[model samples]
Target: MEFFTEYGEASQYQIEEIIGRGSFGVVAAAVDTQTGERVAIKKIHDMFEHASDGTRILWEIKLLRLLRHPNIVEIKHILLPPARREFRDIYVVFELMESDLQKVMQVNENLTAGHHRYFLYQLLHALKYIHAANVFHRDLKPSNILVNSNCKLKICDFGLARASRDDPPLAIFWTDYVATRWYRAPELCGSFFFKYTPAIDIWSIGCIFAEVLTRKPLFPGTNVKHQLDLITDVLGTPSHETLSQIRNEKARRYLTGMKRKHPIPFPSMFCNADPQAVRLLERLLAFDPKDRPTAEERL
Candidate 1:
């Protein structure tokens, strides 16, 4: 029978209201009594009775405790008191943001070239930080991005994540479960992505970049086949001639095996943006994840 105060003092942490709800938790706006600061508290469903999912939720604390960055959601404390919901006893404290990108996108004024640059730059900074920590977001969608009161964006979500630095890329770590369907890379939906390099993260980044530009998903694929189809539809199918240089048959399989189609860029979504940004999207959304741009090159 644990209590909130015994756990820590979020009483000073006034949870105002719910701002966001996810698969396993709800995020609310909170204010700190000690520092007179604003924050967000993510209350993960506590299912102490159910060990597997519960343990995984608890692991969020371990991962959050290890990471620190301006772009990634900042963690302040872990609520260790009485279990809540299905989670045994889990409450992860975070800095409250004014809202998430999803809600922000609803506003008309923020949808333009200028805001796009700022949004993308911030996302890059967050991804750079996660990669430096050797952690892959696995999920990188606009919905997962949140905006602080000052309009700074941060990346969130670590579930469905795996650490590859400790293991060689032997087999798929449940491919179907990796990342969101739309933002998922070619290899993720079909083949292996370069023995598990952080490059896959960049692939996800490319997808995200494409989405932000058009205000629509780069590859809004419903499944494995559709995923490839959506990509080829935009970038056009890769000719064996273009990929004849690829030695590994498995590596070539992604584009070759799938039915290629003509690419249709969605310029209608954006009014006035740099052609360079468009060019960059084409490169990032390549059929082959290997052909995707490096973070340095992107910058």
Candidate 2:
């Protein structure tokens, strides 16, 4: 990080405290020397199996460059070592955000009005803007969302992000980095389709929404098979066409084994769910990704 030492801002940054940590890297709070501004410094985990880990770094750059929404997190710049070392990687500089939705939900007693709807609306706005840019944020859980100075929501963590810009209008390809198990979408449960699309991100948004309402994860399944069971158990088995898209034969067999068209109809989990909220959840938890609503269409 010596290269960053002369960047001036980082040197003056007091390293107030450890903000958070994830598989990708450690987040630290720092003060800027040039302007006395507070910023969040995300130090990327450099010890990747190969050099390909830079893909997400590139994604953060591309996504930030294109998206300029009030709700989305703004990236200051990407920090590199001007000089290199064996394990040295890069860091992304962003204007500091004070709180994340997850923490706010826990601490605030009156979280229903300004805190809730404001963040939700901005989140949806950001979602729509990026989706229009053909960028799919594969991960949308609470920890990834940060609250800025004006109490606006800023989305972060582009590690699992993918783009629809690949040419010939290609499908939103699937990746294993579907955030956490609880936030995982139903369509991803049994598929390995190379053409997985942005619809999966919608399913994740639904999960996050439900989690915010209940202050707990909606489908906190233990494993992949269990995750599939939970999703199938909720939305019912997907159609043959949906099953056909998945390349994994095991996924096909699993779908074929379900004799009932709507195996999930019975045994309602949220029996007391409000009609409006239930409808939203249904749209989100749909077995077929095609059936799920786009992030923009939430309104």
Candidate 3:
């Protein structure tokens, strides 16, 4: 297919095959003719179809431009349609990655402790940069993390991310459902008024780290209630003090009325994991967001 650089330079990229298709758009494997570099191009359709969609597209572009880190996906260039005013497609080109962490985990059953540590370290390294920019990746999961044969990992997909202020205002509800249910933080399960924080991403990282070790989701809940139940079952029921911190009355009451449970020790849960790794996991998975360590602290 024909493509052009932002500076109006004519370039040719042969689409090899369709790589992925999601709600946002289609991604395809391609090769740049001039450089012979393998690349992945995401063609976002109807980016300006609705006001909200246009806003989201712009937000993602802005964040990607600002975020520069080794562990984060790099945007090579943006290819707009020839006619800018009537453009219907937005193509974003990125360095091609061999696969995502989810697929890697599915096939690699003999992952070592060092592999787990390295993956978590790379993830936190990326988070350190993202959070340093006052940005929160609302969606963090194995699928969103790209991995190569060399075992290098990079964080991708910032469509759900938002700028977070140092002192975030309360009741600024962007979306009740932000993250994938399995990796979602407890506060996000049913709490409508919970403010955004980088700690939310830490909760997801904890879930991912657990999955890396066990080769399964830490909390595989079928729905919102079940998700919360799975989390509390392992972490134990939230204390009265923790409940008080929840801004959603309905969620707080639901958690409070649940049968009290003592936390299952991390070592028992991750039987073969490194003791220090388990300790860090516990801190990352704290019920209270305030108790969760920052990305820099985790690193």
Model 3 TM: 0.93
Q: Determine which window of 10 residues in candidate 2 has minimal summed lDDT.
A: 1-10
| lDDT (tens digit, per residue) of candidate 3 on 118-228 | 999999999998988888898999999999988999999888889876454633757766889999988889873457678889999999999998999999999999999
lDDT of 2 by residue, 89-184 (tens): 566778888888788767765555445556667777888887887778888888889875467778887767777756645654556756777887
**Cα-based RMSD of candidate 2:** 3.4
User: Which predicted model would earn the best lDDT?
Assistant: 3
Backbone collision count in every prediction?
Answer: 15, 2, 0
lDDT tens digits, residue span 211-270, model 1: 666556657777777886766776778766656745447656666776657667645434
Whole-model alpha-carbon lDDT for candidate 3: 0.86
> What value does the lDDT take at residue 260 in candidate 3?
84
Query: Which pairs in model 3 have colliding backbones?
Result: none
- Candidate 3 Cα errors over 4 Å, as ranges: 2-11, 166-171, 192-194
Best by TM-score: 3
Residue 36, model 3: Cα distance from true site in angstroms: 1.4
Which segments of model 2 are wrong by more than 4 Å?
Answer: 1-9, 45-49, 80-87, 113-115, 148-151, 166-174, 192-194, 259-274
